[model samples]
Target: MNAPVATSLLHPEFVQRPVPEALVQALATRFGSQCSTALAVREQHGRDEGAIAAPPPSAVVFAESTQDVQDAVRLCAQHGVPVIAYGAGSSLEGHLLAVEGGISIDVSRMNRILSVNTEDLTVTVQPGITRKQLNDAIKDTGFFFPIDPGADASIGGMTSTRASGTNAVRYGTMRENVLSLEVVTANGEVIRTGNRAKKSAAGYDLTRLMVGSEGTLGIFTEITVRLYPLPEAVSAAVCSFPSIEAAVHTVIQTIQVGVPIARVELIDVNSVRMVNAYSKLSLREEPMLLMEFHGSPTGVKEQAEMVQEIAGEFGGNAFEWAERPEDRTRLFTARHNAYFAAVSSRPGCRCITTDACVPISRLADALLDCVTEADASGIPYFLVGHVGDGNFHFGYLINPDSEDERTRAEQLNQQLVQRAIALGGTCTGEHGVGIHKQGFLREEAGDGAVQMMRAIKQALDPQNILNPGKIFTLQ
Candidate 1:
């Protein structure tokens, strides 16, 4: 492993690459009004939900179709300009930043459901379709996509980040659900990585390679993913615990006992209080487990009983069930709004979030230590997690101008990641290694693995024009 280095949450020195005037004029002529150089548009495309600040892209290309993406990419490739793919702009890491100076290919206009193979439980969609949009389109088909990454993120962005949210413990993540992809390479050559087949002994496994590449190797145009039929019966419940340890331990036991939970999330006291104030709901102010079970009525009941018993042993409060669809929706909406609620709690603050996932057996140990440290540091923060999968996040709210706050938050984040790694886990579980987690990525993946990644990046994008200065820096 490379020697550990101090990681900073504050903005790093960004080296801007030149976008020649000739290239700008050519893009305008080719794309007509579809291309934008307006400061507002560029600014919107330049940054994401991540706290890091960087210069906006030189231009933003609003791609409406695969052909549009291809044309834009081809033009940028010819000019040797960096190309950054933009989806819903919901990235929590700096995945959407144009740190190296480039033109952003905005795929949000490409939202469309090309085909739905209900018989085969698969759907092919344009890259810009958001998870909520896709689910709304297929609601009546008796099927739904389960990879909910909290935000209504675009399918392409979700796939690129390998996102998983509350439902991931049971339904798996984008990495497991994505069946195929149509991608535009660095040179603007289009290629199909796989078919709709559920299982393939195909060579190379390129589909997996591109799924979480964070737009480094290629730009995704179309994606085909697995779908599941809606559960015949669904039940949601919440149970508060005396402490985070109790909540997390209950989850560990529940998972180890082989309960097929549909969704399980941990919300610390800080998040619960924020959600109550922001969402106008009266949830108990305690570390809690928000859980769901899906199956036949009898099966769902059995699973809930088992989980509730497990919780009882951990000193958890009685389960508050949300049996009605509306009630369940309201409950989860609050859960999904946790980040926004936390942000709103502290006005004029930016969040430096940490995504660390550990082995199930180490969940309590990994989480408690971080929680204690955060409390001791007196940093305002909120904690939430998909503990059934042993993945959680700490969003430290800090004043942007305060260098001390940023340093402290980054220190907490660095320690959290190191603990996760020491426990046989990853620095990032769902979020990709955007600029924020690059240092931790090196610590986790080691020098040899990162070098291999660099080799792949060079082989695929030799000019280093695709989302350059992300994941890892070129030596």
Candidate 2:
């Protein structure tokens, strides 16, 4: 293990990378009480939600402001030490693993809503604020941030991963929601990019450059995200289908017909069963579409009627709608708990969440075939999707001690990813590659594109000090 976080060395690779002790001393002196070398704390913050391995960080720093990030980064640059930016520790792709251990800068404290520009429909917030926190703060303002990445993730981590969930089908992902950023470049200078205005004739869209960069190019201090007006009329509905194909086809046709669906989600029969047993959600045990319509009362009425007609043509079960605030809350809460239900299907088992997206026309075929494949494999897998976007997740459960099962699951995951690539879709629609997709990046983005990304990395972080050994390996 590294000189720091010498504890939690049960795994061979956890924080074993070399770190300069003199650099740590210098940083410690500079940050004083703000810096910490406590092994337990560092270990706690370093773990990610990856199935491969979750390593701990060597050191930890609770950053209070952008200046603190600058001080820590400058020290790491001088010493050529790796720095890992820690968020809420909810990264499913091992994005926060301190592979080359040094200091893990935790931005949990810098969570303040700097400004809510209602005129521009944007909210400027410190990256550390969680999505739920942001929503709660702006609940009374009639504006909401809508990227729901499953986890109550920090805005910074979500931006780093370009994360999204059910709401993205209507509200869009981080790439679409983020309007600008206050980022600290490798040189430790905090600068602002993008503007409060909706459109910009600016030179380069550097604001978006950092959205999915995963902290490789720079550190995000503040994020300005586009917000949506709370719907004047809203309703949630569930439409059960006889088969996955029928449900997917319904989603496609609903969108094709110009139905302004806010969230159209699919849960296969197996997934519904898991949620019923685990979350005590007594919904019908069938392939179902959980949908939301947002607009004026007349618009919502028209959209709901059109959606119901489409579902009926496909032999869908009777559709049920919830419009009251309490009913809406209950419906969405159950929807959000789909992941927990999948994991709890096998008590005390870790989850393997594999996500992908395909063209809307091909979504039905892909999902139907995947359900067949999942059933044939005889593994516990839950099928759920943001139907309107053709992006879905197969949440698989495996006991940590079952090596053979884990290996089989890995093979299944590889097959799924390959299938998605063949269909002209991304291996990960919203989740950043992190360590999980490093090998597959080339198969998606060609060698030349990868090379350019590496060149940018070298230029920004000459010392390879800011979140090193991520996005691309230093050659």
Candidate 3:
């Protein structure tokens, strides 16, 4: 097949079309076989962990260094080509999709941990290093990065999406942990957005802007993030509730009472069934909440006791707490695999997974409403959530070829997003609005804010070549 097109690429056209063969020739000059004819195949370099409108780019640029990222951006700009930044491709909102058909600058090759500042409790790394790899490198030092999104996602991809997970309740999100970044602007200029200091009264928060920009703003080559000293003592628990609403409510009360939960995830009845059937874990056939606490033995003990008491008040049962390393490992591992189990529950169907976040107070109500409506609508869906942060996912399984099922799924999605917005939450918690949630962004951001964002996009990549048809429309 041929390369894809880029319409208003810096050079002003899609890559697949019959333009000058300049891009291919130039890519061959810089990064030989790393470039691809089918960006779809290269787009496969990194893809959404779950299904969600992922379109491959025209070609893949396997970059080896920060200079490689800079060189490719320059060549693409000179040729008017759209560039889609890619990492582990574990995003959910289809952030790595090159809908405008340009270059998928696959950065996984730049995998290196430059230096570890154990003194400052910070680590500097190339964007390509996965969380697992980074943690493996630093585990010996008793310093670990805590913003986990379940998958072994790349630091760059995680940073771009502002990813957070179970540890968010206690360790905070990418927003709180990222210390600095080396970004490549739309014009191929390399710049540093932040610093090593804990806090800064800088001119503007560009670091925060790039954290969740999801690659639409610029490409990150180097990432500097704050690290945490591993907790001295850790405890894990799996608490069951009569219903998801009850489990969710217990999570709220636990967080409200300042129980210091490291992780508290909601697994609805359907999710429990799927995980059991897939992983053969004979968990109770009811809504479940898997939680963990980090602190000294005395502190964790106190926290777990307080949480159990609060959960008991809300009709939560089976509050099984585990102290041994193996026991805690098994508990969280099972919880992390819940998504894959949900998808594999039904054979031969892909998962269109999406998550939304609301204010902690409104979390229980919104979740109850969405789950009930989805079940009543007879849609094939599963529910999971990091209820500690009021963020949850609805994984829908349907054949894309079947218009009827897709339509019903879309309607359910619209309803869920509307309800989340009504409850003071975002349409997407961390997945982002790549292309799937662009419309919802308007509803969430209002026309005025969207207009300003569009203007910013115009100013940065005027040709709309960076990543077309994402977050906003160009034409």
Candidate 4:
């Protein structure tokens, strides 16, 4: 097959080829002020929230239109130079890093909502538009995009990563939300994958193929996403549990009984402490579940009561309510900022984030074991989860300068992924398999599947010029 692309979780070795001088001149001549070889811009384009420290791209190009993206890709393809798509720069798995060094196409300026079809429950927007921007654009329409990664991330970036968040328990992830895409292929040709229609027995699901490709297959220029009508009633509550296992069991039982919880998140005791400190709140320093229910008022109350009873059986107590809109926003915003809270809890500490998803039956086993291992390691860490879906993240805190700490964290991550796989789970549930999870992806997908992916990559971009050295190394 592809001959075992990566043998380690560390950054892949990339050959740095200088950007062609002729290509640079041509791009500058065409885009003038939109092209930049400045160190500041290149540095900004190079790094993300990932642990890998790859070299920056040789240059950065601001693309304001699909034609702009096509022109840039055409020039880069002509020179056989890599082109990394840049969105909100919030990818956690080194998806945006310019590892092979070529050009970064920043499409943030193309932020425009092209159209909203409330009748069809779909909206078409440029890749540069952020999720919050899209929501704000359609706020008065009584419909909202349900896929939220909580980073104010660009829709393009979210689509590439196939991201999901707390609401994923009910609404589903990007894989379910994205209906179609206008993609600029590696050869600079534009192709539409599907349409705004809800469902069809279509040929191949190209929309899905491009959804989580992380810009390796093609660059998305325009996207159509499914939308949901605003819920008639929404209620949020938080309950603290005596133990992590108890909190997890509560989630499992609630899901098993079919509460249809709109959002159900798990916060470990350590994370709750850090979050309380960082967000300036007085919350119980114990394992907690933050839940939301949506439907008619009676339906919301029924779901909440069922969950409360289930939580009580698992030692959950003192459920607090965030019934007001502002309160709910504050609560969720704090949960979304759990990464920041964990990092700030230890100044100058870098985070090695883990996204492990296991079967609901094995969620407790997986999470409890992980927490026990982290506790045994005596490393500072924080945890948060969308446990209703059996997906969670652990932010392993490490001093940036300490290779020893990094090694320990990587070991713990490996152990967790192995455990999840053994339990019929996945290495990543929401976060895309960027550079970080390349090894685990192979282990999870097998050599045959990986080779199939590599074959597709070669067919689409023979030069390996689009986000090279990501997802897998095409050696």
Q: Give one digit per residue, the lDDT tens place, for model 2 in 137-250.
A: 999999989898778899999998889888987888998889889988888888898888778987978877788998898889999998889989998898898888899999
Candidate 4 matches the true fold with a TM-score of 0.98
TM-score preference between candidates 3 and 4, better one: 4
Cα RMSD (angstroms) for every candidate in the order listed: 2.3, 3.3, 3.9, 1.6
Q: Write the per-residue lDDT of candidate 1 for residues 18-136, one digit (tens) a residue.
A: 89988889889989999999999999998899798888999999999888888888888898899999999999888989888999999999999999999999999999999999999
lDDT of 4: 0.90
Task: Sort the predicted structures by TM-score, highest score first.
Answer: 1, 4, 2, 3
Q: How close is candidate 1 to the true structure, as a TM-score?
A: 0.98
Regions more than 4 Å wrong, model 3: 1-19, 38-40, 50-55
- State the number of backbone clashes in model 3: 14
Instruction: Go through the candidates in order and give the clash count of each.
Output: 0, 0, 14, 0
Whole-model Cα lDDT of every candidate shown, in order:
0.92, 0.82, 0.82, 0.90
Reference-based TM-score of each model: 0.98, 0.94, 0.94, 0.98
Top candidate (lDDT): 1
| Worst 10 contiguous positions by lDDT, candidate 4 | 1-10
Query: Which stretches of candidate 4 lie above 4 Å from their native place?
Result: 1-12
